[model samples]
Target: MSIAAIPTIKLELALQSPWMANQVAITRNNRLFLGLPRYSAEFSTPSLARQAADGSLQPFPGNSWNTWKPGDDGREAFVYLNSVHVFNDETVWCVDQGSLSAGVFGEQYSKPAPGAQKIVQLDAKNGAILRILRFDDHILPPGAQLNDLRFHGSLMYVSDSGLGGIIVHDLENGKTIRRLSGLSVVKASDKAPPAMLAHVKGGTTFHPPNSDMIEITADGKWLYWAAPTGPLYRVETRILRDMTRSDAEVASQVEAVYDNNFSGGCAMDSEGNVYFSETVTHNITVWSPTGKTAVLVSDPRLVRPDGSFISQDRKLYIPVKQPVNTVTANGKSEQRFNIYSINLPRHLDGIDLGRAITGV
Candidate 1:
């Protein structure tokens, strides 16, 4: 499943004024939206949350007092919003980590806020609030934060890096289960050459939220997930759909399988090859069932490729955020981010990623 080296044309979708654009997804109408994690300037202005009635993004609203504070004070009071996914092309869910705003010292010190985070779903076309989901369903340890997610029909699977687990929700029945709590199979030092912990830019070290990233197969039968800090894990939709499955049963199956360091947002081609973003190398790698490695794209311009999607035509659309030149080892860095599309040679035709030993 290898293709010739294709030249990538990088475009700056939104520059630094927006600050730390995380994951992105294309709407049904083909409108592109990127999640802006609350950074100093973005939170300071509430500009990140604002959207016009006509579907254009506007400034985010003010805090409780109607006074807009860009970001939270140097405390655990606020979190930066990171990833967002479009479920039905019309409904979108956004995740926020309240404590990331406090640890902006370039990774020297960081802490999770003593608060339960949330996932907000909004109407992409009308800017209406569909729902806001959060949970106290299960107990969690101190260092936990809700990360990326995916939806199939009426079910939603979310990663909790803070608690080091995955949360599954049946949108139809409102049934929720937090699976694999405190179970992060991928440790920080698992990869060769040591995957970098630095931010998209440079010098800022980023520890594995342990939650990493995830993507469900097109048919919603299997889920391919991995921690940015460790190995990849997957599970069947039947197991996740079975509320009766014991945690141990789920854990046992979870342990059976593991794969590469799929750090960035993931996508599947029509032929079933899993395209993963390797933050450490700044390239996109394809993983096929045959265990063949194909370099989809390898260029310094990509910086950090996050959330991605494949159109029906097999064209790959990746929203790359925070492009930086020199990492911490190289000293000083520059920021360049954008949402771009590339043509792919194959289509995603539903490939079964098999079973896994570890639970998601």
Candidate 2:
């Protein structure tokens, strides 16, 4: 079914910070989870603050949700985490860049120990650290940084957008694979510009280093990836999981699945439809196997739509930032941002592709 128009209703989810909003995810129970990558300080906590089934918003204590166990001294922190995935009702894993002074840690005097990039697996229900998979010694180079991640079953695939490329991790074996270090994928006609091309306040541009978004097929056979400043690429799960291949050999096989330069994060629904923020045009684009490319939303109000999620109710929940015009729902335009819940003109009834299929 082709959607002629998307019905987006703007809610007043006014953001309190100006950091780069990354990704968002909605649980089956309507619990809303979001991520902020470049903020003032590491958000040491996480929770579902959305309105509950009873129509009441519940605010869990900051220390009660996603967090890190402090260093020896309570003041020394351990959280430059960015993206998170809530799975299996209780498991929640978050990516910690390890470089404590990066992102939200900017200019803060908190010193960080060398080699900190790691993924923390937490019990969402209890906020307890189930396991800490540090990658600095495994995947990242001496000065590189780890950014976002997505999980499937026992394996977690991460994107090292900082030093460029993707990192494949084996949770059970504590093994790591760093594929396509500096160049994600090379092509003869690839000339897409970076997604973060606009300048915001304080003369800041959204230029990131490497792959920024990663998604896995429901049955876990394919991994879709893209960078905020590079080409969109993907690889088969079998190649990624092979414990015998050399990094250079794996790089030789990495394929460019999509060439669109998605300036923002990419969202994939149950039906395998890929949605990406076309920052260059202030629009959202959806790509499907039918070889169809359609603009899902193009409202001027959708300035810099970043981390986004599609709910069971078929709603596209997006966290918007740095509006070109600062106008509210009422026509007053100024510079402001908010997290919006938009209703898709089409339902996701056909999104389930059943058992994931392999991708080139």
Candidate 3:
């Protein structure tokens, strides 16, 4: 569809924080939360923080929760927080990648530190930590990174961008299952073109072992995920949550949904409309329930748009990280990273899994 045919969306500046953020979460009351990944030592800000109106980063929940020393247990602190999701129950979930970039190339990062990989749930109303879920070393490889996650009932599915799979967490038993491990569909494509960023040199290619994005259906029945260079895929949540099913059995249940270019992050509205960013094209596209795809917004300023959040009021918030430039320059770059929001149509407001399941 032509750009002029799409609905006119006014890009609203939400927060202009000093530290670059990978993702954002908006609470029911409209509070803003930001996740700052430790891409390099230059990013010394709190891993997970609340963005104030003045663009200051406040240590979320508390200061001690954000502080981590070299010898300290990384599980207790916010170690390389990647994404944050605010649920309908007023709880905020945060994913910690548990490692730092050590080698010269972007793909050759360091191993995760001891007790580094985990998911923490915080009470949104009072900023209190409700629970912490740690992954075992055997299941979560040292190179494995938890990218993004979505909820379905009491279970949470997290995309492992580093190892190319999905980590299914059962809240009831605190047990974890790894699905689609080493699968070609979940892995980043070597043949796909490199991601283009305005300030990066020769563009940034898709590093192997990455499946960085994920989203759940409104009915909490299916999950959709993709790599940067994607043919988006989905699997029935019932197959994932079934403990009796073998890994091979579950893998067979996965199905391809749609082919897409290099996409960064995605979200699904109440109407089952899926929204995702095309990093190379600098535009946002929406896939309706009827299987039609159209550009939502396209602009030169959308440089490397990463994780996005659709708030309760029907506003889509995107974080423009320009990660290619940051990685190519080895984090020694200066770029003003900001959160931008565009108000979606009113019909898209209530189609999230949380509301659909609860009928609230």
Candidate 4:
């Protein structure tokens, strides 16, 4: 079938804030939430926060869960929280990497506080606690840098960027399994990360997190994922959920489907088309369910499109974090961030991402 003509998408600045953010979760009711990995944080910085009607960023539920200083017992709050999702439009799901936090200069590869690493679910309407899922040492390495989250049926998937692999958690059985661990395909490619991450050089230590961003098709059968410096890869959900399958069996199921990568974040539409936010080039590329790829959007103002969301109302929301521009490279004295939204092409549909997200 021939592709539709590219629409003249209007890029609108939705909001601007003082903090840098990478990922965003939008509820069906239109609540906006954003997340960021703790980079150069101060005492009041929140890894996860909500944007209010007044345009202020509030620490998600409250200050308690968001607070974590170096020596403070981080067991109860977000230690290195990053990824967030509005699952089923009814609840909020957050993945706490539970490990490294911002050090004096940059992100530190340190041991996670006890009981800090976990996946927490909350009631979307009231921000009430729903459930918390924890992982064992065997599944998560001591230096595990958990990155992103995706759901298909009863399974919740997380990527361990610090290491290399996909973590699968069964909601029904409360069991967790690891797949594609230590595989080169999931590990960070030697090629430099695009956008602001590429600015580091000469004495600045840098490492690209592996198996970081992921997206699932509407049917929940295939998962497309990649590292920061990437060529996207895909694997069947069945191979990942089967407890009987060995790690090697799951790894064998992976296939490299796209080459032009290096994205900081990614999202999928109901038709199984995956949208990649190329941080380096400030472009959004979409790969169809059938494996064809195309440039969806290219806006120079989208400086380091860190994380994105495709709302139910047919809009692609992007957060321009401007990582290197504000932090160290460009040497800016003041720093602020902006979020943008573009209209999504109208479609009849294929899969309901909602049902895929909840596995209902």
* TM-scores of all predicted structures: 0.74, 0.73, 0.84, 0.86
C-alpha positional error of residue 90 in candidate 1 after TM-score superposition, expressed in Å: 1.5
Flag clash pairs in model 4.
Answer: 22-307, 153-359, 195-280
The alpha-carbon root-mean-square deviation between model 1 and the true structure, to one decimal in Å, is: 6.9
RMSD of 3: 5.2
Measured by TM-score, how close is model 2 to the native structure? 0.73
Per-residue lDDT of model 1, residues 188-293, tens digit only: 3345333454344333445556655776766777776677644666778688557688766776666323355535667654344677876667677667645565
lDDT of 4 by residue, 212-300 (tens): 88887767888878887877889888877777988777777788887746777887787677778887776887777565666667778
Task: Kindly report the root-mean-square deviation of model 2 from the true structure over all alpha carbons.
Answer: 6.0
Instruction: Single out the weakest 10-residue window by summed lDDT for candidate 1.
Output: 351-360
351: Cα error in model 1, Å = 10
State the lDDT of candidate 2 residue by residue for 260-348, as single tens digits: 64456667765567778766676776766454556666666666677676666677777775533355688875443366665665543
C-alpha displacement of 355 in model 3, angstroms? Answer: 8.6
Give me the candidate number with maximum lDDT.
4
Comparing 1 with 4 on lDDT, the higher-scoring candidate is 4
Whole-model lDDT for model 2 versus the true structure? 0.57
